[model samples]
Target: MAGYGDDAGFQQWASENGYDVPSGTVAAARQRGSSYIDAVYGERFPGEPAGGIEQDRSWPRVNATDKWGNAIAVDAVPARVIHASYHAALQELQSLGSLEPVVVAAERVKREKVGPLETEYMDGVEGQDALAASTPLLAAVEGLLEPLLTPVGGFPAMMVV
Candidate 1:
């Protein structure tokens, strides 16, 4: 499937926002941008893929509702998603792999001390996804998407056995 928004939409957004149009094939940039979106935020989205597990993209989710508990049309991709995608696409276009998460050996430094210096690190479970330790979601993009995402570390509104 194509990215969340069309090339024309992206161009329009970039112009209106005063962002320089990145140099690249728009289709390729959009694809990478869309893939980045899925990789970074897919699991945090409130519902399952509308087209099921094999869906090419993560929008149009089933059972996704707004923050107010209003039902979001299953057939629709919200504008926030589109705008976030566009913002991400612009980042990807500017620098390939800019939005990709980096993987590193999980550091386990619980505490360390040196002469006149000491540091203690928070403990975390091992084998966490690399994304957790890598570059965080850009603030602008996260601001646009935060309301639509399920709250991390919080329970779902309903659970079915």
Candidate 2:
């Protein structure tokens, strides 16, 4: 992701969390972790937290507070888009376990879990088989983001009856 963080930021986070990760791997992991977010919630543009204005994609900067009350402000686009709140964005960068299962599942088999590209396995490798266990991992990632992603999709009394 573009503005998820820099090498220094990732290192600082890793150090604070007692985890060791390479700077280059930080970018890759962010990309993959954000990919999972996309799969679950679809693409979240800049205006998502700013007010849900779909057309205002060119904001000089956007700011949104995450569940932890941390301020999330950005002026540029990461390769992957943030979910509006800077904390959620940072969460994606901070959690490698969030992406590990996804990467493993993808490597194991070619399939779409949620918002993934609908890819069919056509490699035609006679007896090739592998285990793709990602649901549990994806659930773990979702749990990490639970407080940030609440039920905001619709009203409780939308019944047409």
Candidate 3:
């Protein structure tokens, strides 16, 4: 699938941030970055993909609004999303496969006891998949996208009727 940001945008971002990537690999890195963005934040976005279920990438949403309640145009992908994609692409380029989700083994011991010691393990904090638990998105990207994201565990612009 095509990435949200183009090679030019990626190049500009790279140059401004002091990162140098091989010219030939920029496209693939951007694609990987877009994949990472979808995998990490797809469910938390404010609205359905503007292109519908078959949409390749997650931005350009329909029925979505900004943090200030301004409508996001159906044909426009937010600049923050594009910028965040650049951040993700740069990271992926620096370390191939760095954005790939990793499924970490969950804690298995709920409780344990030794001859003279007693210990209790709390339940694994509810919700969140092990994959997301292991792979964290870049903090800089997160900051850019936060205003466009729905609050976790809360409905975004839910309808009452």
Candidate 4:
């Protein structure tokens, strides 16, 4: 398997967005995108192809959302589906509003975005939209993340050692 999308896919995304990013930068972005998707959706969505997600091979599913909380249409498939490391990035890139933020975040971490996406997250946002947007990693991943998250309120769990 070629393994989902790659630098080429990332570059295509950049070009379409009018950004002249390098292949390395694109690769980083794609890697980060893949890691992000895998972390959030792997347990629930579980991508096809085993190794990673194949945009073309990935089944089309409804109930997708964008960073702006807008409803992305699933009426028809496009001529080409942009596949990142995982389907999460693919879903974000498929969106109208998410592409810019993800690209921007990816560029910032250039050639090293993958690791950043894999780290622990969503600690104390408390379901605040403003707080989520302010966090770079969360902002880039909010579209896929927020939907999967459930809120827990109280004085926090306690354990005495």
Report backbone clashes per prediction: 0, 2, 0, 0
Q: At residue 146, what lDDT does model 4 achieve?
A: 46
Over 3-60, each residue of candidate 2 has an lDDT whose tens digit, in order, gives: 3445566567557756666556556654554454544443322234332445233322
Q: Give each model's whole-structure lDDT.
A: 0.75, 0.41, 0.78, 0.39
Error of 3 at 49 (Å): 1.0
Question: Candidate 4, overall lDDT?
Answer: 0.39
lDDT of 3 at 153: 68
Q: Kindly report which residue stretches of model 4 are placed more than 4 angstroms away from their true locations once superposed.
A: 1-3, 46-161
For residues 1-161, write the lDDT of model 4, one tens digit per residue.
Answer: 12336666656766775656643344445555555444433444312332234443332334533334544445421212233243344434444234233324333321333655644443333544332333233333444344433242222221111
Off by over 4 Å in 3: 104-125, 154-161
lDDT of 4 at 17: 56
Q: Is candidate 3 or candidate 4 better by TM-score?
A: 3
lDDT of 2 at 84: 26
Local error of candidate 1 at residue 62 (angstroms)? 1.5
Best by lDDT: 3
After the best TM-score superposition of candidate 4, give how far the Cα of residue 76 lies from its true spot, in angstroms.
16
Per-residue CA lDDT of model 3 for 1-161, tens digit only, reads: 89987999889888988888789999988888888888778888888899899999998889989889999999898889888888888888777877774544564566788998989864433464445444655878877988988876633221111
Cα RMSD (Å) between model 1 and the true structure? 6.3
